[model samples]
Target: MRLEGVFARYGRRDAWVLQNVDGEVRQGDTIVITGRNGAGKSTLLRVLAGLLPVGRGKVRDRPDIVGWVPERFPTAQPFAVLAYLQGIARVQGLSQSLAQKTIDAWGERFFLTPFFATPLEELSKGTARKVGLIQALLNPPQLLVMDEPWEGLDAQSQAELPAVVEELTKNGGSCVLTDHRGRAADLGDVRHWQVHQGVLKEEDAPAPQEDAEHHVIEIVVRTDEVGTTVEWLREAGYDVHGTRERR
Candidate 1:
């Protein structure tokens, strides 16, 4: 979809949240939005999902179905986890058989079957976020929009999210998302966009750096063992300083 000079604001009295935001969300593409707090990142995502109407311009070619994962999952729902997601799938126009099948597939993918019967309000933030994600995918959207979807997620889920997103875009789905935890990892070429003061601009990707590059560390040795330690250090071409013990 193409954004043509889009502008948005919360209400009549509120200042504009997005200004002349021109952009594109193409198939098989991943766009990452970055910005400071209150920079309209969330607003832009909502606009992409058609949840918010732009005051000025048109978002052309927005897909028929858009899946959204808000930054925080509403945890006060009365339904069990599976029931909540199932309701979303059914509402999205999925058949009863298809909804059950898809929900179960995603539940297993996120290792969420254990919590399928658990109450929505009872799950922790991490677990609830998983449900938020599964509900979005239940209908297989053409556009997947997420806002800080990794917040409160455990290490395993955090690590798996990139793969899940990759699979979506690989299958011709478009993705737009925001992250405050630096750039995304383990994904293919990403289009990085920064929203500042309600203006959005594309940014050049940073030069790749080796995360496992060699690093130096310091060590201390006992004064009496200095001779032996120094020999070992010299043999290993390492360095250490001897320190006297306090009485």
Candidate 2:
């Protein structure tokens, strides 16, 4: 999808949230939107998700299968967690049986199984956010837009999200996410966009120093999941050398 000369605002009385914003969302791209508070990062995501209409210019070729996880899930509704997600699946064109199956799988994966029967209003903020995240993945979408998706998630859920997003991009899906906490771990080849004064521009991240002096410190882990530890190190940009043995 491409946005050209786009402009947006919440209301007529409000100032423009995005001004002449021109950008592109390509397959296999993970775009991270960043800015200060009230900098219109969420507004940009909504515009990309097609929830907000452009006041000027145009957005072209937005994916038909779009999944959006909002910053806030409306937990004031009266419905069970599973029911809400199944309803979302149905809206996404899944059959009842398939919706149930998908919901069950994501519920287990996201640790939401224990709250399947819990009412929306009764669930905590973090748990409700899990449901929101699961709903977005009920069916793999061509364009996945997320606004502060990791805000209320637990540590395990936060760690799992990067892998899930990596899988999506591997399958040629595109993502646009807004993160205030800067906690988003290594999503490969990510393009960072920053919003300031209603203008968006790509942030130039500093390249890693290749010739910097380094020291090696071996960590002797007792568990059998050494590969997992090594993978984490590599993702954190370490030059790992040991691959002949697993312990």
lDDT of 2 by residue, 1-247 (tens): 9999999998988899999999999999999998888888999999999999999989999998888998778899979998888788888899999888888888888889999999999876678888888988998989999998877676567778888898999999998998765655466678889999789998775345466587987777646777566655643445556754445
**lDDT (C-alpha) at residue 116 in model 2:** 92
- Taking every candidate in turn, the Cα RMSD to the unseen true structure, in Å, is 11.0, 7.9
Residue-level lDDT tens digits of model 1 in 6-33? 9999897789999999998889999989
Name the top lDDT candidate.
2
TM-score, prediction 1: 0.82
Tell me the TM-score of model 2: 0.82
Off by over 4 Å in 2: 206-247
